[model samples]
Target: MFERFNLSEETLKALRKKGYRKPTPVQEKAVPLLLEGRDLVGQAQTGTGKTAAFGLPAVELVDPSRGEVQVLVLVPTRELAIQVAKEVGELGRERGVKVLALYGGKPVAGQVELLRRLRPQVVVGTPGRIRDLLERGVLDLSKVRFFVLDEADRMLDMGFIDDIEFIHSKTPPRKQTALFSATLPEEIRPVIKRFLRPDHGEVRIEPEKPTAEKVSQTVYRVREEELFDTFLRKLEETPFRKAIVFTQTKVEADELARRLRRAGFRAEAIHGDHSQTRRERVLRDFRRGRIDLLVATDVAARGLDISGVDAVFNYKLPLDAESYVHRIGRTGRAGREGVALSFSSDREDDRLQRVRKVAGDAFRFVNLSDRPVESGGRRPSSGGRFKKTFGGRKGKGTFGRRRSFGNPSGGG
Candidate 1:
């Protein structure tokens, strides 16, 4: 499919080197239109190669001879900025097109200095940092011919619309723009209208497919008090090469990681409070299999693209239906079969119903004790035994004897 696109010789060579033999569905549709200098709005889910879908064509059009920022890619998070820049840089390496990732956590002076020295042809960054540089008169967008909003919906969720609009105002009016989002909410329509031309091309790829079909989803009806024990039992019994456990808050993520480590699992936690350096290190270890498990909050794990994750465990239920989809999406990538196990306690029945309504019977309910144990020990499936060990009410129970379920100190 890549052969069909009118990609330049340099990009073609890069694609070949990267072993990109065929185009993903989104890439197949968006690459051709983007290469034709047409603006686009791509509606596709994460892990669908949305980065390369737009990055390839953006690189193919760069005039490497001129040392000007011709392309600007806006992402929601710094991690995504680095990830996108890495992929785009690799594709544009033969052309010697400079690529820079600019984000807030790092020093402003450093990015400003680099912008002055390199005048990078492609800049991938968060909306806030991009706007800051634009106001400081350090980053120039007058020569920018291509603009991309990667994870547009996430940017909206983060309340970066004003910053995106301000940064977009700095770019030339004739430049081509592309907004790629997993799910397009009604709120984004105004922003799209303001930034993109009315005649922009639209590419919708499986917009209704909220979750990957390859993933086998299941729900474990474990009580709140036995959440960790059930999770631990599943971990001990199941065969997971790599797994990600999602929590609702940073505190929960940290507490869960600590618990997992105490249980002798190679675990690490990432959240909004962690420094960029630490987060990068943790993600690197997770990707290289140095860490067997990663516990993270929703914001920390958004746009994360690591393959070979065999399972995903919901340490705690997510607040929204969309978040549940994104959390489970961490696994079942690259045409591989994966498992997603969510724990639905009685207290979370309302949220569970909401998820069921939105997800539409995607998950099969299963009891943890019913699953076959990979090891020799008997599976911990008896609710009576669980109640005896935990010593609490059936419907409302706490992990620790002195604390309640809602107490943050207990970390339940």
Candidate 2:
């Protein structure tokens, strides 16, 4: 916890102003080692205060008087670049450290001007844009002392491996490096071997399937035609203060939000194509309770830290079970109980079963679409049975196994 650590008064005051009472588990373990100059490979899920675990120490290392870039944080998406940079800036505000965020989809000329004028002490950016700036010789990394790769797994999934390697290649080998991810697949081995130091500190937390534990997860079986009606009835019946509806694609997200608005529901759609300014406005409205429901695609919802989200609706099942976990995790955070309702048709039975296998006893199966079943006129066994599709016993709740790399940087 921050109470135990001996940080400077300015940093401590900044944390207190932000109402940070104690350190998260990740911060407790990684802060001391990071301050000691040991490289780290931290494995933890989103919303676990990872930014502060690395950000505070990074801030402490900054020498504002040096007037050059000392810390570089590479993230997967523009949204994340903005989010991480904002948090870092807040933590270092009292120390007079200038933090800048660089990402694609914005004006590169403006970024070049900022770099030339501010000479930011810290830079957080997406790999592609950062690479572009490096190629153009507009941003300098020759003096960077701390390098961080946040969301390493997501960067690889988004096909930024080559760009990430190129960016790392430009930094001096002696710079402290850290790689943090929700999951570490075997494919990351070569990158870890090539980048992290041999004796880097490793702090891994067992990933928690919070959807089952913190949220009441329920699955409703309905025909494709009845899906919308079922979702509408569920929304009408539940007192959801704020909710997020997940769709498979941007078009679907936009269309659904339109339908919801036409039906007298306050909703907005967010996707990759939305301009950054519009996205920020939508998020601000959602946070301020001006908008009650937000419909979003999976990619658009990444790196969002929204509070007071009472429920989550999976309008369309995700393509993968891992994505299901991430979607439902949107709610049920910060010690609050949340509700997750999923509408599944027979065609989506396979996907639902896959989610169940990973979700275990946390998921409760129910058939709410049948009229007779809802009216208590039909027996629970008589309605469409999602369990029948399983055809056999459950798999004892074992889904994808979580791997532990004690010291991945220890190369052969």
The model with the greatest lDDT is: 2
Would you estimate the TM-scores of all the predictions? 0.67, 0.66
Query: Compared with the true structure, what per-residue lDDT tens digits does model 2 show for residues 1-412?
Result: 5856788888888899899999889999899999999999998777789999999998999998877889999997788898999999999998888899999988999999999898899999999899999999888899989999998876775678999989888898789999998767787878788889999999987545655668988777777798897777676655565789999877899999998887778899988667667888999998887888899977668677788787899996777677788888888887777888887874566676667657866776765443322213333353333332221222222211111112323221
Which stretches of model 1 miss by more than 4 angstroms? 207-216, 220-300, 305-326, 331-339, 343-363, 366-412
User: lDDT (CA) for every model shown?
Assistant: 0.79, 0.80
Q: Give model 2's clash tally.
A: 0
Error of 2 at 260 (Å): 13
Candidate 1 lDDT score relative to the true structure: 0.79
lDDT tens per residue, model 1, 202-279: 998763434648787766766668878877766665556578999887888899999888877888998767766787
Worst 10 residues of 2 by lDDT: 396-405
> Which consecutive 10 residues in model 1 have the weakest lDDT in total?
386-395
How many pairs of residues collide in each model?
0, 0
Q: How far out, in Å, is residue 122 in model 2? A: 1.0
